[model samples]
Target: MPIVKNLVTQMSGQIQVESQLGKGTTFTVELPFQSAEQEEHPCGGTLDNPVSLEGKHILLAEDNAVNMEIATEFLTMNGMKVTQAWDGQEAVECFATSLPYTFDAILMDMQMPKLDGCTAARQIRALSRSDAATVPIIAVTANAFAEDMAATTAAGMDAHISKPIDFAALCCTLGRLIGKSSKN
Candidate 1:
């Protein structure tokens, strides 16, 4: 909630609240954004030559259903095959059971039920498979603190993408990481 409020305020937006005493409270946040036609703006790159995320197999680990659905939709739309894992434990197990080198990369949410992403990443790195240390494991989370990033690195994550995710950055990062992995 703090993060949401901060983001809204930073974007010169307003948050409205409606409270009914015996009922519940509703909050509405409105943020300003450039239209699709707006070019040469922040977040980088043009829409016409957008980063290609095609033909890569990605393992996505997110506990939130709505977040998972949104991520899956965008990833699939960009031609990447996604394997969903509802939690960090499931993510670890999914990777463990997968054939080595099957996943080009992993998008792992930091906070989750059962095991957290850091632990899951560590476990994945500890595996004996040939790709265990080679595959890119990207930490996707709301924890953008410096310490949080350090923790992910300590746990064997190759990169970090703070939420709410920047789609352009995500795509470029995936492309760069996967491309690098394929070379090795």
Candidate 2:
């Protein structure tokens, strides 16, 4: 409930929750937006361009099998190598045990059974490895809120991507974070 409210507020929207005993709860969300009359970039210059992830290694931590598969497929399609971890604890362990710079980046899910994403990120950041402080840690989460973004940043994540993940945004973010540019 709080997460929903935070997400609404983060999007410059409002949410009202009404609850009655023995009944149910109703959530009202109001979002402000302007209508788009035409395509902003009809030629699709940047949209048509492919983002290269060649030779980049990504550590992906996701508990859901379906999500993990989909994310992995997307990354592989973009030419990136992916290593999967089912939970945050495993993710932390993987990062800890790996050589410095073994992974170019980490795509972390916020919620998990063992340790949560924030805790895992903190653990990774605290490690003595040279890449611990340098590797890009990105939060791939369903929690799309200002507070959520703040929390990820505080936990040493480099960026945040909301679920029903945007592949283009993911690519752009990865490219920017790793100092690579998408090909035109």
* Winning candidate number (lDDT): 1
List pairs with backbone clashes in candidate 1.
Answer: none
Off by over 4 Å in 2: 1-50, 180-184
Candidate 2 least-lDDT 10 residues: 38-47
Compared with the true structure, what per-residue lDDT tens digits does model 2 show for residues 74-182?
A: 8998789999999999999999998887898899999998999999999999999778888899999999999999999999999999987777678878877876311
Clashing residue pairs found in predicted model 2: none
Candidate 1, residues 1-184, lDDT tens digits: the string is 7656665775679999999999999999888877677654233566666656788899999999878987898899989999999999999999999999999999999999999999999999999999999899999998999999999999999999988777667887888898888899
The list of candidate 1 runs beyond 4 A from truth reads: 1-49
Best by TM-score: 1
After best superposition, candidate 1 residue 72: deviation in angstroms? Answer: 0.6
